[model samples]
Target: MENHDAAALLEQAAQLDAGDPLARYRGLFIGTDTALSYLDGNSLGRPLKRTQRDISTFIGEGWGGWLIRGWDEEWLDLPQTIGDQLGRAVLGAAPGQTVIADSTTVVLYKLIRAALATVSDPARTEIVLDTDNFPTDRYLVEGIAREEGLTLRWIEADPASGVTVEQVRHATGPATAVVLLSHVAYRSGFLADLPGITEVAHSAGALVVWDLCHSAGSVELDLDGANVDFAAGCTYKYLNGGPGSPAFAYVNRRHLSGLKQPIWGWMGRKDAFEMAAGYEPAPGIRSFLSGTPAIFGMLAMRGTLDLIEEAGMAAIREKSLKLTAFAVQLFEAWLEPAGVELASPRDPELRGSHITLDHPAFRNVTAALWEQDVIPDFRAPHGIRVGLSPLSTSFAELFRGMAAIRDQLRR
Candidate 1:
């Protein structure tokens, strides 16, 4: 942890990279350059090299050739197909409980509305949310609360440590209808106790909805094992899905029977071609779908999910812990003395794949780093998010990125 030892950080990084089992996986991405250090994979993951072939094939063979017929044979089933793959490979969920469609905001809106319907009690009209949740999530919850006349119970969590199980327990009560929280804090990379928090919400007769935007592919999630009621996440991050790719939603089988999503479209109707006048919801998870699947948006995810299936989430998670921990160690040694503060949890068990460092000069530093092609996102109030994707990021890349930050600060 000493600066003298830290001076050899680059050499240490090379040694770590040489032994990393997942090291070769980094070459599979589109960008494996030695000069460019992409530190924002938690925000947007690098595309898989296989994705280029997949997209080309889709354009020529899948879309160009099949056209309308593709709808029935393949395109129509993409939502459920990819959803099942994601559920099995990454979510630890069984089939029929997950589906991919719409953006994260839309999916979250539908799931939240569906969850609200399940709670028939007029008195249970409060929605509990953390203050530091993603802006879109907070906005969606705020809009829903205003329209439904529900109260918002805000849990003010530390930006560094995030919302703890104890904080969640204190936030929910008899009046709590639903608790919306992010599995990993977006700004600080704080990993919440999913199973523990879910139990506490259920104990108070409230259903919990998790936003897996930051945790989906980065963390090892067991939705079924955790007995999570509902969840939504974007595929563009750790899943390596392309920008603006459609998000996924999961509903428990128990809730699927009676869950009534607000959006009632032809896709969710039992029979679409029949053109029935009356509205009848489709059976099971299909009801969660209200529009045509984002076939093009989902194309890249197929390749990424294939890689995830090959590597296994257990191994991916193991690497994520080491990568982030190494970043912390490097931060403590190099950046800490350069007036950089560790904004993320020190304990790797309590954190996600990324680490945050805070300094007053980071606003301009991040801008300058971007020009130098060392990309790490800057959050307000001086936090720089160092997003490390396990499959795509290497220790040498992490060291170079951190060293660049250190060098920039000294100037």
Candidate 2:
């Protein structure tokens, strides 16, 4: 019976991979040919094979040859250039409103502060957010509230799901300045209703800022249609830009006028070459810039963004849904019998590109799984996140990883 079950799963994975439209893309990444099962792409994606060649070329030409002149020739506009591409491809945004720079934390801080600055009503002194948001988001809001003498309105969220529109409506009021949220919950892989939540916040006379870390490439984002006020997310995960890659920020075009990001540096000056005294901010999204852009960090994602634009977000989202559904299928068939609880949403529409499983033994099982080359990430309190990146991950890899998890659990 066990052998038959294994054969059935292998057949299911093969059929899924055979019918997959994006399956052709699996081999484009760094190690698709290997037996290494990487189920943690939502935490850190596999690097693109082309990134190596691009880096080699940039080192010999842009850095080695152009030197300081590279700033004048290309580096100055690199942030907005890449930002425009990212906006068009993955963010569902138009040009000139998005800029790529800074860490996601810094970008979130700048946008949150900017949102607060735009509020004219003195009574609107409270920043509303959920308890289950990423730590950086909650921490920034807490510190900012302290700094500006504001109040925090908390929305109690479930670890099994995420923030909902009804919860936002209940938590927000006349005193709410802005609502901070994550588009996709990191732990449970729950995708929040971005447009509905934004509408709720707007109805309460509040702007919305979203953390897009888990949804940028894994799910389809229509930021413009959602009427999002501000947003930030890292590139290292689904964007495949390597570790510590520069993050991107978006501001609605209407908000760009008289908008000032808190961080002001010489590079953000209207005429950075002027070198003259008082810091006059640059025009448009360029003003969001604080210091020199990390050219090296930005290089890898350009290739990935090109791939995203080529494959299109709709197709990517389709494959992501399939991957996670396959994951849940195997989880129920194998891990559920072993006392592993599915920590993520069961519905495909409500889920992001990943899923989590909870078992008391997972606290130690994760390290063991890693030693055997079956890679998934561990969250706090014995939750193992199975992050399936659609572009870089294949159904076969997912099956292998799931089988390994079951084997580990049985021991």
Give TM per candidate. 0.98, 0.99
Model 2 off-target regions past 4 Å?
none
For model 2, residues 1-411, the per-residue Cα lDDT tens digits are: 978988999999999999988888888898889899998888888989899998998899989989999998998899999999999999999999999899999999999999999999999999999898999999999999999999999998899898889999999999999999999999889999999999999999999999999999989998998899999999999999999999999998989997978888988889988999999999999999999999999999998899899999999999999999999999988999999999889999999999999999997899999999999999999899999998888898999999999999888
Residue-level lDDT of model 1, residues 234-326, one tens digit each, is 999999888999999999888999989999998888887788998899888988888888898999998888888999889999999999989
Clash pairs for candidate 1: none
Q: Candidate 1: where are CA atoms >4 Å away?
A: 1-7
Error of 2 at 90 (Å): 0.6
Cα-based RMSD of candidate 2: 0.7
